[model samples]
Structures are given as structure tokens and as C-alpha cells.
Target: MKKTAYITGGSKGIGLGIAEALLKEGVSVAITARTQNDLVETEKHLKTIGDAEVLIIKSDVRNLADEEKAIQQVVDKWGGLDFCIANAGVGRFSPIDEMSAEDWNSVIDINLTGVFNTVKAAIPALKKSKGYIFTISSLAGTNFFENGAAYNASKFGVVGFSQAIMLDLRPYDIKVTTIMPGSVATYFNGHTPTDADAWKIQPEDIGQMVVDLIRMNPRTLPSKVEVRPSVPPSARK
Candidate 1:
């Protein structure tokens, strides 16, 4: 039987790349985002990629009800979900003293609580299918720097949450893996990708990694993975 997957924030960046990869592998996919326009455009682009079914859902990860609805829509359309990717996130960079309460809340709500909502909504279906869960974290989850208070706290919480859930879900044969990537060339944090980003890790590279993980033998599980550009700009002469 053809597998099905659900991806959050799938309109662009890492989510879109993962959707493309899964579609190429003949997995029917459902992608969610907050904007209807982006979802519609992404659906059109995905259709051109392969014959796999693409369902675009307008959803905000910060809302548990929205996430639950998104998951139900996928299951209603595709029967069962074999994978869930919690990739919706945002960055708010500022020192604690300088950060607004609104900015801090937005970052935590979307980045950390969002993951909770996505997984909570999908757990039942995943348990039944013995499926996989992929949470996107960052190197900043572990390494903190200046002006990164809110972003760091959210990602660090993601790492801890993902690990704990990995153990909790493994009992049901549900695989949970957290991927921490550094310097991906994507339109994240208001930065547009350019030729200069050629040296960084491409979003598709992370997508390919997901494909590999799905194809791995069931007996082995790589619970946590950290990926970085092999050579960063700082390393260049």
C-alpha cells in the first residue's frame, strides 16, 4: 500500500523540500501552513513533481484545534498517516532585556508548543500504523549565542521534548527522531537564499535524509541527528 505523510509549515523551506522528496517516493502527502495562498501555490508546484496525491491544509501550529483538524483531514482523505513532520517554526532574535513579551511568546508558542500540538494530534494514527515522527530542531538548540534568547529556549525545549517523546512513543513502535540542522539555504528568519548560500546545506539535502531514514531497517532507529554544512563560510579562506 502507498504510504501517507503529514507535514507542518509545508508551504516552503524545509517542509516543501520534504514534501517533494516524499512525493517522488510515491507517498501521498498533506502539507499545512497558515496561509491559503502559499498552500495553493505549493499544491500546484507539488502536482508538477509527481503523481502522488497532495493535500494542502491551511493551519496554524500554535492552535491545537487547527492541528487536530489538519490531521483528521489527512486521515479522512488518505486512510492512515505513516509519517508526521513537525517543521513549523519561527525565530525571534533579541537579548532578554530587549525582547518584547509578544515576540518571546510568538517564538515559544510556534516553535515549541507547535511541536506538541502537531504530535499530540497525530499520535493516535501514528500508534496504529507504527509510524515515524520527525521534529526539526537547530544547532542553536544546544549552542546559545547573543540575541538568541527566545529562539534558543524554544529549540532547546524541542530537543528535550523530542527525546522524551521518542522514548514514550517507541513502546508503541512509533519512531521519533529529532533533526538538528545548521545553516540551511531557505527563506527563514527573513533571509532570502542567494548564490552565496551555495555553500550551505540545501533544504533538499534534509529532505533526502528523511527519505533515507524511512527506508532504513525497522530494527535500527537513529533517534537524534545533527547536520551541518560540511564547510561553513567562516572556514573558507
Candidate 2:
């Protein structure tokens, strides 16, 4: 049987890119997102890739039950999950002075708590397969900046959470990795990905990195990876 992966936020952006790469490697993939419409569109697009199995579940990762249901469905379809990528996240930029409690809560709930839910749901199956758990954090996790208070807090929390889980699951032979990526050319935070953003990282770059991590020997586990554009426009400017 082909190895199976579950990706949250797989409807678009980096999550979708990872799914594409994994499918090309002949892995069965299951993705979860909030909208059925978006999930349908993603499923349709993934069909063009070949005969790889694709599962789409409409889920709001903020809900623990929904996360569990999504995982159960994948297990039922694929027999087991070999990888779980917690990529469901959202960001809203505003300085602390202007950031509302609701915005901060929303960011924390989805990005951090949602990951907790995803990991918890996948833990049992992962333990059985000695599977990998990958979290999509950001440079904001470690670097502070203005107008990014909520996003930064959530990502920082994610980094901490991911590392702690790494320790918790190490004895089980389950690998945990946190990927902290800098600016990427994606339709994120109101910025449309454009050719001009060529100097920035691309979603596919992150996806390829995931594949590389998977191919690594089990004796060596890279617990954290920090990725940024080799030539960031911010530095050039």
C-alpha cells in the first residue's frame, strides 16, 4: 500500500503544493479545509495529476471533533496515515494598539489550538506507523515585527508546541518537524503572488522541502527547519 498523508488547509497555497508533490511520489493524500466548494475545486484539480488517491474533508480545524472526524475518515480510506501536516492557519496584520481581542483569539484558536487538535487526532494512527508530523510555522515564530502581533504570537506558540510534541513522541519513533518559512509568494495576508515576488520563497519550495525530509534516513530526524528567500527583496531594498 502507498503511504498516506493528511494535510489541513490543503485547498490552496502551500498545503496544496505539498499535496501535489506527495501525489507525484505515489502517496495517497487526504486534505481538509473549511469550505466544501473549495475542497471540491481542489479535488478536481488534483485529479489531473494521475491515479493517486485523493480525499477531501470539509472541516474547521478549530473544532476538535471535526478534526477527529477528518482523521477517522482518512484512516478508514487508507488503512493508516503515514504523515500528518498541520497547515491550516490564517493571519491578520495589525499593530497591538489596533488589534482587537477577537482578531487575536481567532489567530490563536486556528493556528495554535487547531494544530493541537490535528496532532491529537492523528497521534494513535501515527504511533502505529511511526509517522511524521509537520507543522507550517513562519519566521514570525521567532522574529518580532510591528503590525504582526497576533500572527507572531500564534506562530511562536506553534514553534513551542511543535518542539514539545517532538519530545513527547520521540520514544514512539514518530518524527515532528516545524517549518518556519519567511515571506512566500502566495495569496496570503492580502498580498497577491506576482512575478515581482520572484525574490521571495515559493510554496513549491516548501513542498519540496517536505519531500526531502521524508526521504531522510530514520536514524537522523531534522526537528526544525528555517527557510527564507536566498535574496529577499527587503534586503535588496
Candidate 3:
């Protein structure tokens, strides 16, 4: 039987890439985003790929109610969830002195609290499947940079939260992994990915990594993965 995977922010970017990768491997996958039209369109595109079952739920991770609804819908349709990718996130960078409290709250709500809601809603199902949970963090989670205070704090919290959950869920046989990727070529920060940006990691690269992690031996848990471009811009320049 095909295992089921659920992902947030799955309308595009790393989340969508992971969905595509798992679909190719014949896994039933559900994807959620904040827009219904986008979810419908993504569902259509995914159907053309393989026979994997696809469920599209329009959800804003910032809303706990929306997250619960999406999770319940996936569980109802797929029977159980074997994997979850809490990949929905946003970034708004400015000097800490200039950053508004609203911006900080929104980022924390969506990035950190949203992840908490996703995992909490899915835990019972994940526990049943002896599943895996993944958080799409960033290098910023570990290496702080200027103007990244809010974004860094949220991701850093993700790393810590996921690690804690890894220990909490071990007795239940569920695996947890945190994927910290550096400069992926995705439509983030209002920047669109282009062919010229082949030097950066592709969303599909992260997707492939997720698949590999899922397939690893149950006894071997690579709890944290830090991936970076083999050759960075400074090295090339």
C-alpha cells in the first residue's frame, strides 16, 4: 500500500517539490496552501504526474482552526498519515530596531506556532503509522545575519522544537527530522526562481532528500540535516 504524506505550503516551493517527489514514488500526498484557486490548480498539475492520491486543502497555517481542518480532511481521505512536512513559512527582514511588533508576531505565528499546530494535529495519526515529521528550517536557524532577527528566531525555534519532538516521539516509533537548507532556488522573498540560478539548490533537491530520509532504515535516524551549495557565490566570484 502507498504511504500517505501531508505537507503545508504545498502550492509551491520546497513543499510542492516534496509532494512531486513523493508522488513519483507512489505515495498518497495531500498539499495545503492559503488559497483555494491555487490549491485546485496544484491538484490538477499533480494528477498529471502519477497515480498517487492527492488532496488539496486551502489553509493558512497562521490559523490554528484552518490547520486542524486541513489535517482532519487529509486523515479522513487517506486513512492515516505517514509523513508531514511543516514547510509553510514567510520572511520579512528589517533591522530589529525598525521591525514592527506586528511583523514579529506574524512571523512567529505562522512559522513557529503554525508548525506546532501542524504537528499537534497530526500526532495521533503519525503515531499510528510510526510516521516521520519534517520541518523545513534554514541555515539562518543556526547562523544569524543582520536584518534577519525575526526570521532567524522563528527558524531557530523550529530547530529546537523539532529536536525536542524527536525525543518525545521516539518511544512511539515516529521519526523526526529538521532540514536546514541554504539558498534554495524557490519563489521566496518575492523572488522567482529562474534557470540562471542553477547554482542554488533546487526545491526538488530538497524533495529528493526528504524521500531518502523516509526510506532510511528505521533504526537509523538522521535527526538534523544541514545542506548548503557546494560552491557559494563568493567562491565563484
Candidate 4:
């Protein structure tokens, strides 16, 4: 039987990277996003990844109902889930004084509470399948910086929430890992990926890690992963 994965924000960047990687492993992937355009393009590229099925789901992770709908569609289509990657998030950089209520709430809603909704929605299915959960955090989860108040708060929340749930879910054999990645060359932060960004981590690099994590011995779990570009920006210059 083929493994199955549900990836929120799978239309682009890190989520898309993981979806492609899992597809090549023969895993059926259900990818969800709020935008239909991106999902359509991503599903097309995903089909070229390998001979696995791609389920396109138009969803907003911030909404619990939408998340539950995505999970149910996956279960109805593929039987059950083997993994859930909560990768939907956004970042806004500004000093605390300059940040708007909308900025803070949007970030926290999608980045932190969004994961809460995704995990809760997937729990029943995950327990049934003895599944894995991957939460895409950031280096900011542990590190702080100026103009990063909202982004930092959300990511920090992700690390804490994921670990707590890890403890709660072990008895059911559901593995949870929060992935904190440093500087990646992607459309994240509104920056277009380019050749000059080669020094940074690639989305595919993160994808490979997800595949490796799920392949680990069922007896062991590396619940937290912090990945960074081996070459620092100063060194890259």
C-alpha cells in the first residue's frame, strides 16, 4: 500500500518541494491552498514528479472547517493519511510600533493557530494510520531580530505547540517534528528566487529532510530539526 500525505500551502515553495519529493516516493499527496491558480500549476508540476496521485484541495488553513474538509477529502480519496505537513504561513517585517493589529493577527492566525487547526483535524485519521506530522517553523523560532516581532512570535509558538503535542501523541504512535529552516531561496518574504540566492538552502533540501524523517525506524523519533545553510551569508560573499 502506498503512503499518503496532506500538505497545507503545498502550492508553492517549501510545501511544493515536499510534495514533489513525497510523490517521487510513490506517496499519494493531497495539496491544499487558498489560491486555485497556484494549486493548478503545482498539481501540474507535481504530476511530473512521479507516478503518484495528486489531490488538489482549495483550502485556507486558518479556518478549522477548511482544514477538516481537506482531511476528510484525503481520507475519502486515499483511505487514510500517513503524514500531515502544516506548512502554510506568512511573514511581515516591521518594528512593533509600526505593526498593525492585522499584521500580527494574520501571522499568528496562519502560522500558529493554523497548525493547531490542522493537527486537530488530522488527529483522528493520524491515530488510525499511526502517522507522522511535520510542522515547518523557521530559524526565527529560536532566534530573535529587529523588525521580526510577529514572525518570531508565531514561529516560537509553533516550536512550543509542536513539542507539546509530540508528548501528547506518542502513545498513539503519531510522530511530530517541527522543522526550523534558515535562509531558503524561495518566494517566501515576497522575494523571487534567483541564481544569486544559490548560497541559501533550497526548498528541495527541506523536502529531502521530510522524506528522511518519515523513513526512520518506527521506534525512534527526532522530534525537532534545525536546518541552515552550511555556508553563512558572510561566507557566501
Comparing 1 with 3 on TM-score, the higher-scoring candidate is 1
Predicted candidate 1 versus true structure: per-residue lDDT over 97-191, tens digit per residue: 99999999999999999999999999999999999999999999999999999999999999999999999989999999999999999999999
Q: Arrange candidates by lDDT, highest first: which order? A: 1, 4, 2, 3
Predicted structure 3, TM vs. truth: 0.98
**Poorly placed runs, candidate 1 (over 4 Å):** none
lDDT by residue for model 2 (96-207), tens: 8888999999999999999999999999999999999999999999998899888988999999999999999999999999999998888776678878988888888888
As for candidate 1, its clashing pairs are none
Clashes of 4: 0
lDDT of 4 at 165: 97
Instruction: Write the number of the candidate with greater TM-score, choosing between 1 and 4.
Output: 1
- Give the C-alpha miss distance for residue 33 in model 1, angstroms: 0.5
Which prediction has the highest TM-score against the true structure? 1
- Residue ranges of candidate 4 with Cα displaced over 4 Å: none
Among the numbered candidates, top lDDT falls to: 1
Reference-based TM-score of each model: 0.99, 0.97, 0.98, 0.98
Query: What lDDT, from 0 to 1, does candidate 4 have?
Result: 0.94
